[model samples]
Target: MQLGCWQDCIGAIDGTHVSAWVTGPDTATYFGRKYCHTQNIMAACDFDMCFIFISCGWEGSMHDSRIFNEILINDNVTFPHPEEGKYYLVDASYPNRVGYLALFKGNRYHQQQFRRSQQNRTAKTSRELFNKVHSSLRSVVKRTFGAWKNRWGFIRDMPRYDFANVQVLLVSASMALHNYIRRNTGNPTTVHLICDEEEAMTIVNAIPEVEHDNDDLMVGDEDPQMALMRLRIRDKLVYLRNNGMLENI
Candidate 1:
């Protein structure tokens, strides 16, 4: 994670909904916000676009934060957890907690916004600049998801299986294969081939809206300790930017 001032960042965490076919009593449980039966697949990926952790089998209707807290947090999953002073970059769907660093909500923090700022060469405010860097670094997770789904057609539209557990197994196997290919080949062209510009843009635009019911209560109620930590990190990033350390990137 060589994200300028965010070098302590271990990885990025996010969730992607995979279409699933279900019937009978379980259909209602799998019906998701997209008006389709699906499975919410949560994953953590490093800066190199390699998946470090993945958790599937959660119902599509489940909130990302809930899946994270229940499956990853309560279960003591240490793979995604970072060491002291390290954190994973997450989206607005997750809380701005100590171990997780979320972008500044209600602010411009997307690739489009960053590109526009770069084109104008406009000196951005501290928060805007922080968000610019945050968005760029976090995009790796989105690209990884897009490339994985594009590489494996089954994940894009999973077929109806006799057993629901098979869906989970398929997803696990796909991720394992994805990692194997990435490690053995040591080539980024494979990832780029799967996730073209159009496909990547589609995935970015298709990101599900934040679940208001799950996030509304926590909005604007950030813990004082966590708030201070964010401030320190933001200031350090600004310092790095001022010193021209990030201009090349």
Candidate 2:
């Protein structure tokens, strides 16, 4: 659960597409990138693999960024708001705003990619080091999704529920059940055990350092202030790395 220098990070945010059945005028809307009817489920999860917030029922074809923006616009207060100087770790698909930290776009960021590249040598630049750490920490959300789908067959291959209400009900009930199990009997370690030993060790040894590669930076449409905040945070991460403090974490 240690997020290295990002101790103020509360959780991770990502979207998962769940297959669904739809008809009539809504059929096209639900047809997603997978070439099937689905629901783009936006979820936030803590380090323990427990979901903190979930927003379901968006069209499968909708972009993840769009869904997140809609959530902020429609239910800003209800959505989990990070405290001052706190943020959530999000993937490149999300905007690098004050409340959310995103990985450097066009950089090596996936766990598999990092492992492969690191096999030869460690990260060479600050951005590479940052991405290495970012990928390792953000993997919790991916594992959470895997564990969730493995446990609930209904969500894996959702039956043909003709009504949207029924589909939403099923989705909500499944998420509730997931939380209940996690809170009661779930072992956080077991969720991560699905990975092989080498990969696990890679994550453990991923102590990031700062670099100076700002080429093709993807800051998205963030306002100037938020963009600067993001840069400051990255600089802070680099500072910690160079000072040998990040390794102790």
Candidate 3:
């Protein structure tokens, strides 16, 4: 939960692809950075591995930033707007807007990259250091997706539901159940009620349906105020690291 200098961090936002079954001839619309046909699901997950917000039913080809921009601009979507000083950790693929903090640009990011960089030296530039710690804290969203897919095979492999049927709602429904399960983790009765995957799917299917739409591109322009905010955070992080005060983070 400690996000280095991002003390007001509420959670992380990212996109995940779940296998999708397409019937139309233009299946290319459903293929993105992934080779397989999938639906891009944009989610915001807190440190507890529970989804707080999500945007689903996007075609596989849509970029994460596009989805983010679409939701933010769409009047009907009603995003869970962060508080005045709070923000969410988003990867480089999304825009670093007012309430979305991202890793420093044009520097080392990702765990594996940092691991390789570490093998060569013990020292790191401020940008590299920030990216390292930023990626670490942002991993909660990925882990949340992993836990969701691990628990529900249906999410990993869809049963070829129609486009207008459960397919539109599957990702959100799964996440809704994920949050519910995470909230009641210690309750034996909840465990017993959802232990079976089929029963869990049945429960998900019973929830009221939600729908979605598509949008256009979002120009990746860094906001000046957010840029200054990141600079301030970097300065604070440097101070903490220099003083050996970042040990708790």
Which one is best on TM-score? 3
Candidate 1 stretches with Cα past 4 Å from truth are 76-79, 115-123, 188-221
What lDDT tens digits, residue by residue, belong to model 1 across residues 74-149? 6566555777788888888887887788877776777676556556444367666666777777888998898888
Off by over 4 Å in 2: 117-121, 189-220, 223-249
* Native-to-model Cα distance after best TM-score fit, residue 162 in candidate 1, in Å: 3.0
Model 3 CA RMSD to the hidden true structure, in angstroms:
13.0
Each model's lDDT comes to 0.72, 0.74, 0.73
Model 3 CA lDDT for position 143: 83
Better of 1 and 2 by TM-score: 2
In terms of TM-score, how similar is model 2 to the real structure?
0.79
TM-score order of candidates, best first?
Answer: 3, 2, 1
Prediction RMSDs, each to the true structure: 10.0, 6.3, 13.0
Candidates in order, TM-scores: namely: 0.78, 0.79, 0.81
lDDT at residue 45 of model 3 (Cα atoms): 82
Weakest 10 consecutive residues of candidate 3 by summed lDDT: 210-219
Which pairs of residues have clashing backbones in candidate 1? none
* lDDT per residue as tens, model 2, 14-92: 9998888788988899998999889899999998888999988889999999999999888553898888888888987
Better of 2 and 3 by lDDT: 2
